[model samples]
Target: MSRTVFCRKYQKEMEGLDFPPMPGAKGQDIFENVSRQAWEEWQNQQTMLINEKHLSLMDPNNRKYLQAQMERFFNNEPFDKAEGYVPPEK
Candidate 1:
């Protein structure tokens, strides 16, 4: 049977991840509190942010910035947008 977690992002009980996403305390926290669906969504957003900002994971500062962005994204806090990216005219 699949596992369930109280997804912090969705604010509902949902299917949990099969394994810890990261390596340590934060990964355990996510495993205990975040849902698979929410994690996937964050992954997609992270990809876009990385590509848009031309972030190099090899750089320590870049990794730190991405980690901060990930936290803000999951917590429903405001986050940075790609430079020069404008919303489509509504």
Candidate 2:
């Protein structure tokens, strides 16, 4: 059976990640508090942000910006999105 966490983002108990999605204190915090579903949502958003903004992880500033956004995302705060992006409608 999978572990459950009180997801900070969804604000409810849900399935937790098998392991921390990353390293360090932030990753451990996320592993203990963020649900897998929320993490996946951030992954999608992160990918979009990277592509639209041409973010390079090699750049410290870019990585820092993404890290901040990730924190905001898990904390259920307003986070930046790719400007001018429109979801495809079916």
Candidate 3:
């Protein structure tokens, strides 16, 4: 998901926790960094799972599925087409 969306979702979850606000952090932006890190961790886990299972995530249908998810995360806007903006190859 987009950073903002992820942050909003995470912020909601975090509201149920007892974590204290970080010093000097913006209330609204509090979850952005943590959410981005979480997303990265999630991607790594997915990659590891695929590798361990010898899965072919490179299939055309798989590519489309991933693309759609990315688009959804991006608020349904077209994904970046600029060179070097491609999603993970796998």
Top candidate (TM-score)? 2
User: Judged by lDDT relative to the true structure, which candidate is superior, 1 or 3?
Assistant: 1
RMSD of each: 2.7, 1.1, 13.1
What is the C-alpha RMSD, rounded to one decimal, of candidate 2?
1.1
**CA shift at 55, candidate 2, in angstroms?**
0.5
Ranking by TM-score: 2, 1, 3
Q: What is the C-alpha lDDT of each candidate?
A: 0.90, 0.94, 0.42
- Model 3 compared with the native: what TM-score? 0.33
Provide the global lDDT of candidate 1 against the true structure: 0.90
Please give the lDDT score for candidate 2: 0.94
Off by over 4 Å in 2: none
Candidate 1, 17-71: lDDT as tens digits: 9999989999999999999998998897788789998999999999999889888
The top-ranked prediction according to lDDT is 2
Residues 1-90, model 3: lDDT tens digits:
232333432443322212323345532233333355444544554455445445477687755655454434424344323233345777
Superposed Cα deviation of residue 6, candidate 3 (Å): 5.7
lDDT of 2 by residue, 1-90 (tens): 999999999999999999998899888999999999999999999999999999999999999999999999988789999899898999
- What are the runs in model 1 whose C-alpha is more than 4 Å off? 83-90
**Distance from true location, Cα of 36 in model 3, Å:** 1.6
